[model samples]
Target: MIRLSRIPHQLLTWGIPMGPLMLLRTRGRHSGLLRTVPIATLRHDGHHWLVSPFGDTHWVRNLRADARAELGRGHRFRPVRLVEVDDDRKLEILHAYRGAFGLVPFVRDAFDADAGAEPHVFAREAHRHPAFLIQPAG
Candidate 1:
């Protein structure tokens, strides 16, 4: 995991064309070691949301311990909190992403490319995956 502390490097990575990766910095819950990881993200409603296609990764664990984190999206550093969406609304949110980003096939393949499952199946599984709706701290 690459912990990004420099704003310039972050910008260079995300700012460039085809740079969709975001650098998330968090403090380890038990080890207290600062860790950084790259993730896919989408911006919405003046906030950024990150979804872990792999589910509950290390960065997610770190954020769970401490909501405070620095998001490096294309050289932009914004302090944000990891907000867990209500389970009741998880499917709705996932659907919104699918519609907004045209991610039906993409998400389906992410969950199980070989399962030959429907979009609903993928959506249901995606709900179980860890996701963070980021909001900047005032």
Candidate 2:
């Protein structure tokens, strides 16, 4: 399934619109080299938001190991410091993600929230998933 996702990942990163797609480049925790993965992201407020989709995946682990990462879309790239958000703000970001993509089932199942649930409902289950606040690495 992941291998197949990479096919569309390449297409969306290069051939199609990048409005919802991005490349997350993290320094491999063990290998000490760059590792890039395509992710669906939403930019809200002043931060770029990314959900694990799957819980505590490799990329999430890698970024947690090293907050120095880059987010890219086609020709554009930005150095970002990833901070796991654990406040009311995270729910706001999560709500924006649902509103933007209507990826409710995907998110709900991943985070163990009910369909059409409120942000507060999901917020209670926040520890199951990680939402990052992408800040300009300055």
- lDDT of every model, 2 decimals: 0.63, 0.76
Q: Write the per-residue lDDT of candidate 2 for residues 1-138, one digit (tens) a residue.
A: 478568756865674665677788899999999888888787898667887757688899998899889888566678989888877887777666666666545554565554466778767666766789878898
Segments of candidate 2 deviating more than 4 angstroms: 12-16, 104-108
TM per model? 0.65, 0.82
Ten contiguous residues with the weakest lDDT in model 1: 110-119
Per-residue alpha-carbon lDDT of candidate 1 for residues 1-138, written as tens digits (9 for 90 to 100): 234325544554566533445677788999998776666576655656777655777887888889898867455667878887756545545544444445535555455423433335545476456767887765
Off by over 4 Å in 1: 1-19, 44-47, 73-76, 96-108, 112-123
Cα lDDT for residue 88, model 2? 81
Candidate 1 lDDT (Cα, 0 to 1): 0.63
